[model samples]
Target: MNTVMHRKPKPYRSERTTAHTSDRNASAFPSKRHARRYWILLSLFLFGGLLCSLGLLLYNNPVPVQSPSFWPVVERRITAVTTMAIAALCQSLATVAFHSVTNNRIITPSLLGFDALYSTIQTSMIFFFGAGALIGFSGTKAFLTQVGLMLVMSLLLYGWLLSGKYADLQLLLLVGIILGTGLNSLASFMRRMLDPSEFDILQARLFGSVTNADPAYFPIVIPVVLIVSVLLFLSANRLNVIALGKDVATSFGINHRRSVLYILILISLLMSMSTALIGPLTFFGFLVATLSYQVASTYDHKYVLPMAFSIGFLVLTSAYFFMYHIFNAPSVVSVIIELFGGLIFLTVLLRKRSL
Candidate 1:
């Protein structure tokens, strides 16, 4: 004991302190370089989207720039671009938020039967009321009606399912799937009974395209979207926490169920608006959100949402522009987009091997 050298023990340091290093990186990005890369990528996507939109409005415009008809033609194109912006905003924001809340990157808002409900409504219109009713079942009034119907049903779903002791997301998803499958079967049966001419016309109406949108709904849609989008942006931080799963979110003092319910309501509104605005783009949101995760290279919704919107806008405008002017195949543009989106979906599934 006497021979023991009295050595002052090394001052205690936490693992955090001991491990601190200049090499440490952000959670989402591996290094500072990756953080910088995110901004650079964001800028590029934004610029590309704007360029495509301008090209859509002006490129191959047969009317001379100086002529009187030119402005009118451009004005018409403006409507299409506006529709693209709304659709992009809705899909991107909704999908990203939906992913965060659900804690699942693979499934999309379509899982909740919004798309199925939309399809059923359209098919039922043609089946019961005739194709003429389906044709006339447009304009601003009809648009609002469809949106209202979607929101109402979504509210009922959220309210009824998310309130009990047995409140469970998996349960809700299962119920939605069952409901969707039944509605889909009904719609399919109705479609089969229709005359070929009616079926053809109905088929044309069902395909999502810019031409399907009417500019008159813009005034109503713009205000609602702006309001909801603001709400979402304000909830970005909360979304980040929620994305980490319920247990983690609860430990962090968040009301996981309530937050999820509120967020789901917002998502429903977004999906409804997009579906009403331009029919159902089933995989468009998935495509946008997936590419955004790759391009954003971060878990931050604030940045991811913007990136998704930019990419979506770029995809839609560029696809329509190139298809119409270069390939003269505007009719198949939506088909092409869905095909690519489906292929990408399969690739992701195979790579992950689990949803």
Candidate 2:
């Protein structure tokens, strides 16, 4: 026996092995660097959008004085800009959060009957209490009540669905669709019974509109949005995990049930805020969320959330700017937005891509 000390089988360095190592290294670092670059690009886009909106807001002002004092004009412009920014931020954040919780980009918080409940609540108030009562309805108090009701309803629905043996997301969505239709029918019935003047009042609230937003409501809305955003940011990592499907998440020691519940409550609060602030936007969330995904090309919540918000801000701000300045009709923005958003929905559906 030639006692040749068997050298550990010469490490077989195959071409495949070398290629895999190279691929792994590239994946490990290049994507991260790419994400950073994408973030920078997004930041630049937001800055450019803001400057454009500001320019449009100041274009051809009717103030008696030519080029009024810079500070006062700047102050007013800032106020308008702030309002648009806050509203866009709140809506986008809420929509993205809603999509994440459901694990389906096609489904929005509004689709889960929150907006329907809002409509029913508002319509019922007008029908029973009459239009005059709307004047007495404290905006903050009403908003809180609506949010609370939405939370309860969402919890009940999600919990009930989870408790059942045959529960599935598709079933839940179907139930929501039916419930929403039912609520809309109820609202329409009530509207038909109202007097002509009352019908006019109800009609105004039926469709989505942002023009009626009152500055007084911002005090409450801003703080609520900020708090929710902070909570979302902290849980951003968990959201990314949750997106990998419930089974995988549970294996990773995540409490899937509890996490879903928390997400539902957060979505309800957000839906209530947006509905109260600017009425029901049936397709706006779908439009913005889908568009953001296309633009960002990543599912990381850290990137997706901010990108969605920025896109939402840009779209809404631009729409308002054009309607008020170029079109000389601020009231038409909502209609145009709805029309465009609907077309986007159809286009997306036709493409058959997983939303």
Candidate 3:
């Protein structure tokens, strides 16, 4: 009876095998087309929004539209646009590249104490030379001094913390944070000693504003931003590899240390120019970079970089338009941006459960 019905068993394929095959196919090229399409649509929308914001800023004035006041309004709008553009590029490119090199999302270029150092420079100029010196400090020489100091300081930190057989990025960041805190402390102490009027003047300088940037500085800032941005765009391929980790990057014949060093230097320069121009924007870079990653939905630097710039431009221009036109308080734009960016930072930190 047992031998009577020897039927051949069908070839066996379990549910696990089927599921794994499905997973592999699902992950191999998942959502890439959708991401590309989304980026294209988002790009068009942002560009349109930017143009509308520009129009609002330029043409939506209360003073007589056809009077001599029109020229002043036009001039102011032009300067605002120029400042916003430079700020956008600087924040976008520097933040994206900084994130790539550090491979960390929570921190920003501000960690290196560019803002704190700027505060110190201002406070010291006020504390030692009195607040009136700030007037003289607004010229081109002071701009150059600020850029030079930041460059030298960043260079020293990079060389000190990232040049050994065991280059430790954590140590560098920790030291930077510490120095920044110390510098802030000194500035605060000095601020406390200043007269009310001088302190008020220093306080004004602390707030980042498109109007605060001197037009004379734009000549230098535009060129520096353009050159650094082009360099960053060219290095996108290297940054992509670097994002994979030092070990993986080395495996691909990338000099991980050198690439990182160079990236930091370039980032320092960008931050210096931006900070020197607009004071310290602790959140704009972080906000734009985070939004860029989410909206672009891809890891490729080529796509992400331009997306970051566009988003930054859109955010800055829209903020300027709303604050200057709608709220009648442009000085608070940095505060609003920093507030939202801090909330985003907290949300991301809780969600990721890791730095």
Candidate 4:
């Protein structure tokens, strides 16, 4: 009567079994629903961008669709669209990559002084040679000159600030800021000395706009951008590791300095190309990166980069279409963008309460 009943033995899970079970729920997103959400957002951005692009091309067409002149009209608009795409690609990628390497979300690659350098170059051209010369400074040669100068300056900074025992990222940025301040001051002084008419001419070049981009430069600009863009996209994985900080990245067997240098060079090429082609879009990149982060809701650069690029394309296209077509205030489009971007930046800054 005192006999105990035997209980059924529980099955023991092996480590492999446990790991597999845990991994079954693991994904880029927290769950299946999140994965679905990300994809849906991405698709929406793409679709919206597509619609805006079409609107740019077809809205308010002066020529009839059947007319022989129709395609030419469309072709002319295509230049603007292409310029938007290139700017989006360059700014979005370069900003994201710069943020990753620096491990800071608040600062953009614009802090590296590309914009200042561009302003200085334009100002110098106008200051020394006159407005006529500045006007003549177009075509492939002028485009290449701007790009080459920016790259050379960036390379020199990297070499001087990142190679020695005292090499520090903060130091590099400090120097960049100082240089930018100096260049900006110099440019401002030169502007003050110019006649109103010449100042008027240079003012247009100073503003970041698609009209600043000449299609003639496309022959050289497109190939370089595509190549640098691919290289940056490929570096996305390494960026993810670098974003974890130097200690973590080193533990993962990554050459932290080398990776940082590589990324900086790529960023230089991207920013140089973008600033040269479109002038100083200072906050556009920050705007894209911030929005993309909110939309993507993840830190994976693979997703973040694409999401950034898509949002960038949509933002630029939509902004241009609305301002140029609907609002009929095309000149203020860049100003509008910068305003919103700065507002977003301040909001993010206040929320974080620290840089």
Pick the TM-score winner: 4
**Alpha-carbon deviation at 246 in model 2, angstroms:** 1.2
lDDT score at residue 222, model 4, on the 0-100 scale: 93
Backbone-clash count (model 4): 0
Q: Tens digits of per-residue lDDT for model 3 on 68-186?
A: 88778778778878888889899889999989898897688899999999999999999999877986788899999999999999999999899977688888999999999999999
Per-residue alpha-carbon lDDT of candidate 2 for residues 50-160, written as tens digits (9 for 90 to 100): 866776657756564455575576555655666667667766777787777677877776878877887798789889999987656656677677767877777788878
TM-score to true structure, per model: 0.90, 0.82, 0.87, 0.92
Deviation from native of the Cα of residue 123 in model 1, angstroms: 1.4
Which is the better candidate, 1 or 4, if ranked by lDDT? 4
The pairs that clash in candidate 2 are: none
lDDT of 4 by residue, 234-300 (tens): 8878998999998999999999999999999999999999999999998899889988877787778
C-alpha lDDT (0 to 100) for residue 120 of candidate 4 = 97
TM-score of 4: 0.92
Candidate 4 RMSD computed on C-alpha atoms after optimal superposition onto the true structure: 4.0
Candidate 1: residue pairs that collide: none
- Model 1 lDDT per residue over 24-85, tens place: 64566666787798888888888888998898899999989889999999999999999999
Against the reference, the lDDT scores of all candidates come to 0.86, 0.74, 0.84, 0.91
Candidate scoring better on TM-score of 3 and 4:
4
| Cα distance off (Å), candidate 1, residue 272 | 0.4
